[model samples]
Target: MTDVKPSCLEGIDANGTDSESAVERTGAKPAEMVRFTATPEKNGATVESENASQLDQATLMATRPNGGWKAWLQVACGFSLMFNTYGLINTFGIYQNYYTEQFRFDPSRASLIGGLQSFLLFFANGAAGPLYDAGYTRLLVVTGTILIVFGTMMQSLCTEYWQFILAESLCIGFGGGLTSFLSPTVLSTYFTTLYPLAQGIAASGAGVGGIILPIVYRELEPKIGFPWTVRVIGFILLATLLLPVLFLQPRMIPGAGRKFIDKTAFTDWPFVVFLCGNFIYLLGAFTPFFYVEVYAVQNKIASADLGFYIISTMNAASAIGRILPNFVSSYIGPFNMLLLSSISTFVFAFAFEGAHNVASLIVVSAFYGGVTGLFFALQPVVVIGLCPDPKLIGTRVGIALGFISFAVLASNPIAGAIQSRGGFVGVWLWAGVTTAVGTGVMSVSRLMKTKSNFFMKV
Candidate 1:
């Protein structure tokens, strides 16, 4: 056997003195050595020396995220992206009302248009993610900005059903997808410890936009007509998108050789389980937002103006929901927060069935908004945790969201069809059942992750 020398030890020198002896000789307290120690029986002196060198190199190469003004700026840019993408999607009820009233389409047809928009917004991300990973983030943002502005402007001139579908559903939806996919993915690179809080603040911008845009449309549409009101909204998007163009950045250099779709991620069972649960959860996720205003009008719970306010009220509550739950989620894992939000959403969907008056309607809307906000804010973080490689986060998130987009696409129109057959009761019951099923699936995913450890943060 080779003899072990003090010089081969992690915290020893060529003088055959270890750190502890040196400390004592110099009358100094022992300091922790930042090196790996290897057992003599397991590895010889040469192997131990190599292990120590490898550990030193790893320490030198490791880089923690730089959280400062630059990082928060990325958060702000993420806020702007959410404001334009999900913000508008959340307020589709306002558009659905306008289209059915103006163009004389049935509720299902109107819902179909909104659902198509949501589908594109989510599905297009599959391509956008790979593009971003390949170093096209700037291109994606610029192209998306142009399409969204152009599409929104074109919407002002549309009168026919096909025209609206082309401008609103296809162009704007595709544009929103480009920006939305890049925003959170880039923001996540700037944080590890404070990720949940950063994402929550970024997502709260959607709540703020949801509250403001509906009120803007309600007040503007009456005075300037639908055409100019839409034009005004388009201009606001132009102004807000500038922030992302200027400030949104990625820390990793573009990996041009990397494939857009990472096939390896498919083998991660935990991630696969999470994706299945997410799809089920999203099936009923937006049902309330899409139909709540119409449901209120149908049930005589509120007037037209008050029905509009209901959307805003829910979004106002969502602003609080987005921030608080995320901050708390830092202490308890994101999956725990997601499980709680899923359970609460399941309960509140049932509350919609019991709502007969304006008071109960508003209460249920607020409560549902709060829980859903938690779902949205924590979603990206949960996916990040399951990801094995940080470089592939964009691709993984994009593909998962692309699959979930199908559920979002079909949900609203399905809810409308159910309402047509069974009235408001049918809609509420469908929403409740789907949400409950989603909750159960999510619970199973949690169990799979933690092996039924009820108190584990994961």
Candidate 2:
């Protein structure tokens, strides 16, 4: 057999040779050939056409490393980003509790700051997705790092409600949003079979960071003072975020011409209903993270110091939850795993209402965190699975997260308002009911996709 060059056309090449002869000699099928045309520019240089770039992506997608040093490195970068983004967000309960005690702010009003910050932390993804798809991974990460560091520093100097809102809510929220979702989107390009597992590993960084930051804040704020403690956090953000800014890589073509709202995604009933369930669940999800410490302290279930660690405990279990369930999901299917996780979360939401002692609260926190961790890890996997075009995953994920931003933004404040009139029981009951409804809605999506087969891997 002769070595033959695969060709898009069967006629003569630029070299005036027979293209069909080249194809026949190598026995290369038409589908296996690299598809592109080279056109000469005015400078007598040859440039591959846009079709070449598209073909390059398809080729890379099929052959991309599922796991290797390079691929796993992105996971590490993702972990670091999550450590800074959701890690800190998970610790917001500490801030809420602190502001309530020190400043005497209304829980409902103070929650607005956290609500705004959380809002942009996800909402920014709408714009960030298109930017990531355009190959601005480094730019987005670096800019987000700068803003996060700046916001932390600014938050140190803040003494007023509006000032905290400006620095923490606007600056940090937008900054973190730009970086937070990009890791999963990037990982989707590198891993196929191991996508969920890789995402879980990366997302666990939030759990680890969540566990540590609360301890740092609790221990340091008393000794170093609030401003200096916040500054310490700023320095940590600067250090950790530098890794992704330095080395994170996007594996797709620079421009796929995606829109922020994929109108097509909304038309798919399964996708629409699934997002609605996610929306309702999110409305209750972070409410616990923002209030567990406060609940423990106010109810005298634990000392203030011990109460703070409940957040850490939840996050530790959450780290385990993020990793193990996702590993299991690789075999069972992400949608199936999501349904199970949703049911568990719904159960835990109600279980919190029954806990009246220190031990019971801690147990509830652990179980709740673990289940929510699974939900967070599964988000990207489910979105990618639903997406018809792999190239549009980022955009579709961004749109889905836009719904989440509102859910989180309104969740805490609503909980706070509910707590003001009725107490934590009202909050707990609301969380449980919403999660239950969300679970039921999500079941609809699963059933629709699996053709109502209860045991399908779907």
Q: Compare the candidates by lDDT and give the number of the best one.
A: 2
Which residue pairs collide, candidate 2?
none
Per-residue lDDT of model 1, residues 1-458, tens digit only:
12121111122332444545554554534222222232222111111122343232112112224367877888899999999998877767788878888889877788777788889999999888877766677788888889888999999999889998999999999999998876667766666557778888888888999998888898899999999999999999999999987766665444448697889878877778788888887888788887888788877889988998998888988877888878677667777888899889889988898989999999999999999998888887777666655556678889888889999887877887787799888887787788788778777766776667787775
Candidate 1 residue 453 C-alpha distance from true site, Å = 2.8
- Candidate 1 at residue 252, lDDT? 44
Q: What lDDT is reached at residue 449 by model 1?
A: 65
Those runs of model 1 whose alpha carbons end farther than 4 Å from true positions after fitting are 1-62
Per-residue lDDT of 261-313 in model 2, one digit per residue for the tens? Answer: 67898798888889999998888877787778879988899997788788789
For each candidate, C-alpha RMSD in Å? 10.7, 7.8
**How do the predictions measure up, each by TM-score?**
0.85, 0.87
Please count the clashing residue pairs in each candidate, in the order shown: 0, 0
